[model samples]
Target: MTTLTYKADHHWRFSPILWGALVVAAVAVYLIFQDGVHLMVRWWQRDEYSHGYLIPLIALYLIWQRSDVLSRIRFDGSWVGPAIITLGLVVGLVGELATIYTVVQYAFLIVLYGAALSLVGPTAFRIIAIPMLILFFMIPLPGFLYNNLSSQLQLISSEIGVAVIRLFGISVYLEGNVIDLGGYRLQVVEACSGLRYLFPLMTLGFIVAYFYRAPLWKRLVIFVSTAPITVLMNSFRIGVIGVTVEYFGEEAAEGFLHDFEGWVVFMACFGVLFVEMWLLLRITGDKRPLSEVFAIDSPQKAQENEDTSARHLPTPFLSSVALLIVAVFGAASLAERQEIIPEREEFVTLPKELGGWRGRVEIMEQIYLDTLKLTDYRIINYTTDTEFVNFYSAYYDSQRKGASIHSPKTCLPGDGWRFNEIETHAVDGVTMGGKPLIVNRVLMTKGDRRQLVYYWFQGRSRIITNEYAAKWFIFWDALFNNRTDGALVRLVTPIREGADAAVADERLQEFTKELSKVLPEYIPG
Candidate 1:
């Protein structure tokens, strides 16, 4: 016993006590940065934070097991300590510059803990580094990735929500990703999607795994099941609400089911957690040397020695690590702020005149001269006008026209919609932002309800485009030039002065026939 005690007293390893303090400090930082967690939380959160708090306590509790090695730990100052500290400081500064606040701050703690491990000698270095590298999971993903996740969540939740409704024996019809529940429609809004629970639940699961000193297989089971469990339970909750509404009444669903139900569902999740814990314990056979779990820590010394005490590392090693740290911090900082280059406009030439119709297509004085022999002429320049002062070309109009087809013309509230029809009386062209557009007055309708449609078409430069035009750019050429130069005919059809899709289609067909006389090749029969 005395010989073993002597060896324990002389051995050096990364002290659990140091690990505990570092964990406490990290928890403190997170609590302090609560206002900014939205930016900081990328990879891991709930897992890391709770672990931070628990590890210290566990280390203290487990101190007895480590007593053999305790006396061997001695204060040894090394150049690596200052180097790590310096590297951490640099990481924080660069993170601040790029706004990757979480990673930069976390880097300091990682280096501090890692360097302290170094003091335990190379063996301790490898042992500690092996587990500590899991810190990478804590970093937040880039914004683009988050968006994709969000979209996926939206789709999955929306679809599953409808299925849940049907499973409740409620007559539900799903069309084009929309769920129709009797007269009311529930569009799984982004907030209602399961993604909100994903990050949080995964975090909770990881922390729970670390809390139980379960074997690797046990931890894997808990971790992998996190998201599926959360999403499935949430779907059940939504399904219950739909059942209540269909059978009991809307008041049952909206008044009680919709509003104050989150708490109840959350409680349900916790219940499932208890069951999960019980199962895990049974499956893994709780060999709970509690202190080893890092949750119930053994009492630790108030302060511990640094790992890098008196060690010399190659400059190249330091350089490579620094570069990697800088890269991670940089990525975290630029997550949401990538610069997008604006699209350049395309241009084309057109004839000065058409046969029989003088000045049908204008040739401006600021002209790049070109001539063609045809009975009719049209200008296909991208600009709305040839006038250098105002600069007009039908090409810009044509481009914007097709592109706007992709977006909903109706504003979120529908107040922006207007309708108009062709009339002999000329109305003044309206300029929006800095660009001018032709304003036509037409009648409008919504869902079989009739109303007038007063709409405006901007020629695509210096103009505030409508919700539709701003969204799509595919139509610029079709409206500006004769896409299918028809058998040389010219005619016009004034559509109904309204916002009805039915009316718009009829008008479009008639209007196409008018222009088809000039260019009939592109239009489908």
Candidate 2:
């Protein structure tokens, strides 16, 4: 077998041009940090993402542990690194303009990977890829995806928790994400969605997989199983909390013991991860101890490997670095320039009387208003002797920041409503200028009560049906017209017992026709 080794060589290997490139790269990173400081703020404030602070430290340690192998590899930079660097810069620019931190963070990681490839060769890139990729777990999911996932996970965890409570001979009833233990009620809000455990455990799982001296498939299995393991353990935590609250008082679920239980559950998750590693060793007949299976570098070896690495002088990498620096300055300048928000009528001025229907405005509580973070909104109920329709609109003047319209699909289930069916309904005559107007038609039920809801996104100059499409248009319009104004309009009417579904549909269509006429003045289509 051919054996390769690196003797301790502590001298610098970069040429004058490469040294200049290094300075440019540092400038680029400083620009990125200007925008990325918010992530640090979020790490401190958001409990679920607090692990963000530790991710970089862990990733760095992993990369250091592999130093011995990386030092021996030859360095030949590739032009592909520059191409990737340019892509990352462009993505970062877009993200900064759109004011979406998730996109900006992804662009930052991509740029870092490109920089690594430019500093070393493809072999070193492959060796350090896992540790680099593990850094991704630090970026929080976008609001829309987070809301959808959190809502689903909350429901699933609640169901499993209630089932577990019953298994322990405690009578329990589940309504959506609400668990009723006859006397005490536990509502599974977004905080208890188990994402807190999932994010950190997945990060730990990747680190374990990197160190485990096993086959490729075995490593993947150990990594992939973290998700299911997190879900199961989190459900058990909720079940245990419910049982405690039933036996003791509500204080058990809220005070110091509650926090103590969370820590215990997290420790149990780690214990389970170690047990999994042990089982895999037994199955593969490796006969190695669990500690040895996932061993790290010794101090002597790490010190030896930390001496220095050979460097290459590549024109493409240097050129890419220069261009990236230029792009960073450009993005920073663009961020400083004020965006032109279009002047339009506000939803607060919406008329109470639309055509013949009598309307009454419903005011929201200050707490809900604060949570929604909307610019303006209206929740008006229009009624006739035979039927009642509720109209709601949430408007955002500038969606450049984190503020934007939320999808009702994510919000509906939290209030004990189960969706029976959802589909897009096309209304031909009800559209503006005789164009086809598409809206989401949904049927939701709770116990024996049922409601039909019709909703659509009213953008600057277009009416949209799909939520994803609305996001695309928001980005597009924000880019071109410098306008990110949009609003969500929803009309809901209850289907009375023994009432015909067709009649309710007709009533909504007729109301939408009148709505199309008055929406433009307020929403400015």
Best by lDDT: 2
lDDT of 2 by residue, 119-211 (tens): 675766787888899888888877677768888888888888888888889888888888897777888877677877787788888888888
Write candidate 1's Cα lDDT for 372-394 as tens digits. 11222233211113111111222
Per-model C-alpha lDDT, please?
Answer: 0.42, 0.77
TM-scores of the candidates are 0.45, 0.88
Once fitted onto the true fold, the runs of candidate 2 whose alpha carbons sit more than 4 angstroms away are 1-23, 36-44, 72-74, 97-99, 260-262, 299-316, 363-371, 432-436
Q: How does residue 301 of candidate 2 score in lDDT? A: 47
What's the distance in Å from true for residue 404, model 1?
23
